[model samples]
Target: MGVDGVFVAEPVSNVLGGLACLLTMYVTVYRRLGR
Candidate 1:
């Protein structure tokens, strides 16, 4: 159960973190280019 929990949690956390990072980067670049 613990192993399964870790497996599920790790991917979910990584995906969220990656998306957040990508969104921030995209916004920053878009603003810079817009200006």
Candidate 2:
């Protein structure tokens, strides 16, 4: 159960991290263009 949990969590965390990175990049670009 512990191993399974880790496997499931790893992908979810990775996806969330990726999305956060994309969002940060998008915001930075948007602000730069806005100026």
Candidate 3:
């Protein structure tokens, strides 16, 4: 028999998005400083 896939939910979508933005900002700053 084949296995079935499962579904997951994330209620903190905005929080995750904010975290991503912060990470991106940090990377940008690091690159600018490294140059």
Best by TM-score: 2
Per-residue C-alpha lDDT of model 1 across residues 1-35, encoded as one tens digit per residue = 68999999999999999999999999999999999
Give the Å shift of residue 30 in candidate 1. Answer: 0.2
Better of 1 and 2 by lDDT: 2
List candidate 2 segments past 4 Å from native.
none
Best by lDDT: 2
lDDT tens digits by residue: candidate 2, 1-35: 59999999999999999999999999999999999
Whole-model lDDT values for every prediction: 0.98, 0.98, 0.73
List TM-score per model, in order: 0.82, 0.92, 0.63
Better of 2 and 3 by TM-score: 2
- The C-alpha stretches of model 1 lying farther than 4 A from their native spots are none
What would the per-residue lDDT of candidate 3 be over residues 1-35, giving only the tens digit for each residue? 22322222243566788899999999999999999
lDDT for position 25 in model 1? 100
The C-alpha stretches of model 3 lying farther than 4 A from their native spots are 1-11
What is the alpha-carbon lDDT for the whole of candidate 2?
A: 0.98
